[model samples]
Target: MADTDLLKTPLHDLHAELGAKMVPFAGYEMPVQYPMGVKAEHLHTRAKAGLFDVSHMGQVELPDPNAARDLEQLVPGDLQSLEVGQMRYTMFTNENGGILDDLMVFRLERGLMVVVNAACKNLDIKHMSESLTGPVISHDDRALLALQGPSAEFALSALAPEVATLQFLTGKWIDVDGAKCLVTRSGYTGEDGYEISAPADQAEALARKLLAQDDVEAIGLGARDSLRLEAGLCLYGHDIDETTTPVEAALTWSIGKRRREEGGFPGADVIQKQIAEGTSRRRVGILPEGRAPAREGTEIQAPDGTTIGAITSGGFGPSLEAPVAMGYVASEHAAAGSAVNVVVRGKALPARTAKMPFVPNGYKR
Candidate 1:
């Protein structure tokens, strides 16, 4: 869709004023990059702090008193065990065990605050409304933003001093520049950061405050994708989707141990079976030998030229200064150091399965 017809976030005008190159993404007109270009923005994010406008994503409130228990039935997380002000990364599974969508569930004092992907927000809410007999309210009046990197706390604390004490994966309602905001010490860039859910009207002002810091710069989606890729974070609809199971996607770590044994959520039986036994294939990091960056849909083959899988996410790692990729391959070939071939064009390119997080993660755990 064209930018004219796409939805605009609260910072849309601000992005334009910053000379951002707008692009249509997930039904929203979002910034892809600024005049500084993608490479510089990406490197700056690793060294300092980068501010991102993530308002296009959905913020929903599950207001039912039994929100935790009710939510447990939909996702494979131990939501009932979550302490107030805690957040979890989990996914909604289908009856057949495929991922419906990956979401962040935050336990709040009044109810649960959930963030879903922009593209899947509507469907996720619909799924929840039909699955659980609770009130699902979408907070369209809110805007989301992220400040990430080693200096994230320094940048955010200048405005909200209390934010400096927040631990990873924790949240609280606090005053940010006189505006009530839901602030969480979490981010998608594998850095020590905070995600702020602020009132729509105050979002732009809050963003400008953060950017005013000497360590912070406005980042766009282009650098966002590269940073997350280097961190081995999955991009919904690409790395994971309705056809991919959590086990196959190597996301078993996010599945709570209690949920593993209880077997209550969707596709529990199949997932449990896969957990005990094993799946035929598994997701693994691919290190392409040459400078040529392999892209998504590139074919994977064994040493003997037998086809095994295809690349789901692939790109050059700016942090590593080399080409890195990830794909699902046969279980036997999924181990690190196992040799594989990535067919970029017609030729089979030499590559190997390697440990993920192409760069070291900087999450302040």
Candidate 2:
């Protein structure tokens, strides 16, 4: 889609003023890079702090008194165990154990707040409404921003000192410049960071204030993609989809022990079975030799050229300074250090199965 035809976030003007290269993503016009380029933007965030405008993501509230109990029927995560002000990364599954979408669930005082991919928001909302008795409400009047890096805590603490004391996967309501906001000690970059959600009208002002900090700089989608790749996080349509099972996607950890044993969520039968018997194929990390980068749709082949699986997501890792990717292969080929060949751009590039998180995550515990 063209930028002119896409939805614009509240920070659109700020991005343009910063000389960011705009691109169409998930029905929104977002910045792919600034004048500093993707590589520099990525490294700067790792060393200091990078602010990202992710307001295009969908925020929804489940207002049922039994919101947690109702949500447990959709996802396999143990929502009941989630303490107030804590967050959990989980996925929606279909009847056959396929992943519908991945999301973040925050346990708020009055209700449950969910952050889902923009493209999947409508379907997710519809599904939730039909599946549960809870009242589903989408917050279209909000904007989200992520401040990430080693110095992220310092930058946000200057405005909300309480944010600095938060541990990973926790959240709190705070006052940002006198505006009520939700600040979560969570991020996609695998770094110590905060995700702030504020009223749409106040977004630009809050962004400008954060950017004014010495350690903070505006970042774009290009660097954001690379950072998540290095963190071993899955991008919805890429690494996982309706055809991928949580067990097959190496996301069995997201299934809490209670859900695993009780089997109440959608696809609980198949998912629980896979947990016990193991899956036929599994998502694994692939490290291609040399400088060649494997891309999506690349075929994974055995030594004899037998096709096993396909690449879902792949890109250059700025933190590792090498090319890395994730793909699903047969169980036999999913072991770490196993040799495989990825057919990238018509040539079979030598690749080895490696452990995930190409770079170590520095999230504060």
Candidate 3:
């Protein structure tokens, strides 16, 4: 709420020293952009590498051997199938089958390492504690740093040579800048990268080391938004929320075949029904005809003036050099190339539904 009450990430001073313009986000004072500007920072990541301070996100540990089985009660992912060191993306759902929060679950040797959104982490923890068995541990002393782009491997390998062995959606314990850290060869920026969870005390030092490497720029929230938007990734509380089902979000793929058939998770019945019968609306990408970006909440309409949907996330894609967006529209209009119009400032802008990841994903399989 108040600026004085905002939480500071471990890299706060580093961000300030790098000339970042700070703002309040999810109860934290974070860098919105640095001196290089959002556009330059964005292109830098696409061309080289960008370092992001995502410590605001929550990290939780489920230490029980039955964590996977316990997890199936909350989300639809096939967690029991995950091998050691592998990671999967899924979401927490409400009883109505609407998405509560999206998260990444890493099956480590001892337990499960889960990373959730900053805005929803608290509720996710409470929900998990109430539903799962004992001992849900929160990592308040950890900081997460995302090194993303083509050079991510090259830069990160200098510190943790073993990191190069990790494929996409995999993680392992490693020493980064001499700090015992959990390094994952995974990212959501549609680029090759790693997410490092390091001790808070050692975070700044590790971040500085990564920054010292060639081709790594300190990125802030401004570019982060554009990068994820271009990548067609959903932002919680915007593109998805308590009212949107996984099927409606086009995220049915995250549901494992067994889970889909068994129908054991919260709202699984509703999700199964949606899987058999199509949902009323589905998420899809939209490309505006011109440079004027269709921002979130902009109403989407059919060519004949019938309202079809609204833009949940929209912005100028530095990599695509065009305005890219994703939103939900009636299932009939969700098909790529379907004609649509985005109402921005009471004027209709010609647009069309397009495929996601407006920028091609570069993840290493």
Candidate 4:
């Protein structure tokens, strides 16, 4: 894409003024890190607080009373059961049970709010519009920011005291320094944090206000990726894709029981069958034996040197101070603690199957 066509978030200039290293990601010129680098940013966030600009994600609203029913036809989550001001992580599946994209749905008054990956937002919106009969509106005027870490609640509480009361997976409208915004008690870093959605025009002001807090520091895409990886969260195009089913991705929990029994969502038959019969391959966490990080596309091999699967997402965990990754392996070899090998630079790196969330999640609820 041309440079002019690259999308810029409301805080683009602010990132530049802060001496952040810029990189193209999801068609947006985003900050990869500041002068302190990814490791420092990562550690800072875990220790205190990190502010991240995630405005590249798509913000959309469904404004019909039947919106829940309309959305239920696309994703596997039980939207109707989601109480107002609550959020749920869900997936858009195809007819074959493979994921189109994993997204967050927030139950709001008079409508449902959705946040989707930027790369697949257009396609996702088009598909949803074609499949549902509701009035789907894309909120391009909004921007998203994530404030994460142990001190996140305390820092954000200074601006919106009510935000501190929200539990994990719950959200509500709040005023941040006089700017109206939506705050969700959820994050990708396995930390007790909030994701704020506000008008694009007010995003920069909100970010600055949050950073003014003693505990909050500006983070970038580099640390954000590492944090999510350490948390064992799936990235859209990597850990999950059109070819990966929810069952195979180890995200079957996202499928509501009612949806599974009702068989109304797309690919319900195939997904329900996988739930019953099991999938041939399953996504599992892996921990390599040394400091050497495993990168994507690394071959995961059985002890016998037989290729079993490939690494989807991998990186050095700043918190664990070790190399960690998540990938699909044959069902027979998917158990935690199972011995495996990751081919790194043509050399077999000793690795072992590990349980997810390499670091424990610190959500309040």
Candidate 5:
């Protein structure tokens, strides 16, 4: 696509100012890396704090007294009992048990706020509109930013001291330099962090202020991808898609226990059956031996060269100083420590099934 055809986030100018290498991603001209490079940015984020421009993500507000009840019909999470200011990770499932998309649903004071992936926002909006009764208010005027790492709390507290009290998966509206912003103590990096949504007009200014903090530095998409990969978080298009079911993706935990028994959401029948009978395949982390990184599309093999699965997301773990990957494999091979092989560069490299989150999660909760 032409550069002119790409959409620009509110932080486009700021990214360029920081010497970021712009790339096209999810139909947006996004920053893939900065002058400091991916490794530096990744380590910096782990050691201190990093500011990420996640404004391309989609946000929607659904208002109602029974918003959770109404939204429960489309997703498997237990939204009905969700307390105000709480957030939950969930997926929009299709009738066949396939996942349409994964999202964060937050129970705000006035309604439910959902944040979806940038690529699927348009279709997600349409899907919600067709399935729900209440209005689905898309927040095109809002830009989202993420301040992630161990120093996140310390950095954000300087601007909004009230944010220091928020625990993981909790959100609240707070004032940042007089700008009303909704801040959530959650992020994709598996680090203790916050995702902030502010008016688009003020987003750049707010980001600049955050970047000015001693603990914060501008991070780009390259580091963000490696961070999430090391954390064992799924990337929408790569790790999951319309054909992957929550059961197969090792995400059944996202479904509430009551929802499992009651079986009301879409694909509940298949999901429940899998829960009872077990799935044929399951998502698991792969730790390849040696330094050679097994990348996405690499075929996973058994000891006998039997084809088992393919790598969905794979890369060098900056934090672990090793290669980490996640993919679907037969249920028998899903156990941690099970031996496996990865076909990389025409050679079967030794590997093993390992538990996820190559590095431990640092959520405040």
Candidate 6:
């Protein structure tokens, strides 16, 4: 796509001023990395705090008293019972149990807020508009920013002290730089962080203020991808897709027990059966021997050369200082510590099915 055709975020100029390397991602010209480089930026985020311009992601609000109950028909989570200010991680499933996209559902005081992937936001909006019985209001006027890492609360607390009291997966409206913003104590980097949604016009100012903190540095998409990968969080269109079921992706934990017992959501029968009888294939963490990072599409095989499955997301885990990957494999070979081989460059490299979160999750629960 031409550079002119790429959309720019509210903080585009700021990213450019920081010498960020811009790249096209999900229909937007986003900063893939800054002058600090992916390795340094990633390490800095793990130790301190990293500010990211995630305005490309879509935010939508459902304004109806029955919003949660109406939205529950499309997802497996028990959204109807979600307390105000609570957030839940869920997937939109198709009739065949395949995931349309994974999203964060937040129950707000007046309604519900949903954060969807940049690529699938439109489709998700259309689906919700047609299926749900509420007014689906898209937040095109808002900019999303993520402040992540160990010192996230410290940096953000200076701006809004009430934010420091928020636990993981909870959010509330707060005053930041005199701007009324909705701040959530959740993020994709497996760290204790906040995803703040501010008015588009004031986003740049908020970002500038956050970046001014001693512990906060601007990070880009390159480190964002690597960080989420190390955290075992699935990237839409790569780790989880319309062809992949949540069960096959090993995300059954997000399904409520009541939903599991009483089928109501789309593909509930299929998902329940998979839960009862077990899925044929399972997503598992893969740790390759040595340093050759196995990338996406790498084929997985048994010791006997039997093709088991394939890798979906793989990369060098900066935190682990090793090559980490996740892929679907036959359930027989999906057990943690099970030995397998990954075919990279026509050679079968030894690997093992290790547990997920290559690095331990640092969420402040």
Taking all chains together, each candidate's TM-score versus the true structure is 0.99, 0.98, 0.99, 0.98, 0.99, 0.99
Candidate 5 least-lDDT 10 residues = 63-72
Better of 1 and 5 by lDDT: 5
lDDT tens digits by residue: candidate 1, 1-365:
76578999999999999999999999999999999889889999999999999999999999887999999898998899889999999999998889999999999987799999999999999999998888999999999999999999988888889998889999899999999999999999888899999999999989888888889999999999999988898999888888889999999998989999998999999999999999999989999997988899999999999999999998888888899888899999999999999998799999999988888888877
Query: CA lDDT, every prediction?
Result: 0.92, 0.92, 0.94, 0.92, 0.94, 0.94
Between which residue pairs do clashes occur in model 2? Answer: none
Per-residue lDDT over 11-101 for candidate 5, one digit per residue giving the tens place of the 0 to 100 score: 9999988999999999999999999999999999999999999999999999876779989999999998889999999999999889999
**Once superposed on the true structure, which residue ranges of model 4 sit more than 4 Å away at CA?**
none
Which 10 consecutive positions of candidate 4 have the poorest summed lDDT? 257-266
For model 4, how does the per-residue alpha-carbon lDDT over 42-105 read when each residue is reduced to its tens digit?
A: 9999999999999999998998978987898889999999889999999998999889999999
- In candidate 4, position 295 carries an lDDT of 91
Question: Which prediction has more favorable lDDT, 1 or 6?
Answer: 6
Q: Between which residue pairs do clashes occur in model 4? A: none
Off by over 4 Å in 5: none
> Which portions of model 6 show Cα errors greater than 4 Å?
none
Can you give the lDDT of residue 66 in candidate 1? 92
- Report the error of model 5 at residue 160, Å: 0.4
Number of backbone-clashing residue pairs for each candidate, in the order shown? 0, 0, 0, 0, 0, 0
Q: Cα-based RMSD of the predictions, in order? A: 0.8, 1.1, 0.8, 0.9, 0.7, 0.7
Error of 3 at 297 (Å): 0.8
